[model samples]
Target: MFAFASLLALAASAAALQVTQPSNSSGWTTSGPNTVTWSSVSTDNSNFSIVLNNQNTYPQYNEVLEALIQTSEGSVAVNPPSGGWVAGTGYRVNFVKNSQDLSSLLAQSDDFTIEQSSSSTFSAVPLLRPARPRPLVPCQSPQPAPPPLRRLARESASNTDSSAGSSASSASGSSSSTNAAPGLNVQTGVYGLLALLGIALA
Candidate 1:
């Protein structure tokens, strides 16, 4: 019975105690299913849990961000609290057999990095609007077109000829009667008959 008890104690001491993931170069985001892996010498039935800690709060393990799982799976995915981590380095992963007891630490990984997720770190940007167009000016009324040069020249020549004919008719009245003889001037014929009768009587 003593030998059996000693063997059991040794086996229990050798159970899940070595962390294999979240190495020194690992970069885990606060909002992700970051993989946490470890080794266990015990049977597959042994349960384990994970915790996130900051390297600045080292030996005390006070700054602990608890994961949302406790299972027997040696390798599992754990997401840190959305509001837990800031963007920086020097983060560590802690493996524990019981989440309620930090004293039951099973394994500890090297210092890794935790950062703010892209979704949470984003901010809203303002949109750009197009400029307004200027108002148009009103148009003025059109002017009337001038008379054509060809028509003006024809009217000027007709007026000149009419004026010259009127001045010549006023300068010579008897010549004007002779010029009207084609239509038989009655004044000229009467004056000629009276002069012939006077010549006969004398």
Candidate 2:
């Protein structure tokens, strides 16, 4: 019984040392292609890393690395030089560090047949949906349609015609009065002739 209890305690301790993926409660989210980040985990001490197998066979291993780092943060550092991978490749990741050489790290046994290199990350957290845009409102009340321009133009023309008619009528009346009056010179000549005849007769 004592030995069994000790074994169970040892197993529990080992389990506790194992690294766990971050929880969804954390704000961390996975984004981009072929990349994912552990959330709720302490970024300061916890190191996240991935390993690619059959790199020569897979053409997109390097692209995966670039896309992974592009999507996740808190990498601390990367190894094996960047930009290396081929199609039909397998890979694995280690959340914790074991040694400087990283020989004991987990490696994926299955091969990955590349199909248009995946540039997406597997996130434990839910994605945040973008907020909807608000409807636009006019800044000021729309000015009532300007008084119909055509109506204003017509009214102005009517006023002008009425004024022209009044002026023409006044001019015509003045000319008629002048034509009716006898010439001053003709009246004076007639009076002078009458006076001369009267004086001669006298």
Candidate 2 least-lDDT 10 residues:
21-30
Q: Local error of candidate 2 at 151, Å? A: 2.7
Give lDDT tens digits, candidate 1, residues 1-202: 9999999888786674677888877667766467877776644325656777775754744344544344446677665465655667777777666777766776788888776776753446878789889899889798878889998999999999999998887768877777788557677788899999999999
lDDT computed for candidate 2: 0.45
lDDT tens digits, residues 87-194, model 2? 332433343233334454422223333333354433467888999999998699877887788999999999999999999999999988887666766788899999
Candidate 1 stretches greater than 4 Å from native: 1-16, 43-45, 57-72, 82-84, 116-202
Error of 1 at 178 (Å): 99
Question: Per model, how many backbone clashes are there?
Answer: 0, 16
Model 2 TM-score, 2 decimals: 0.29
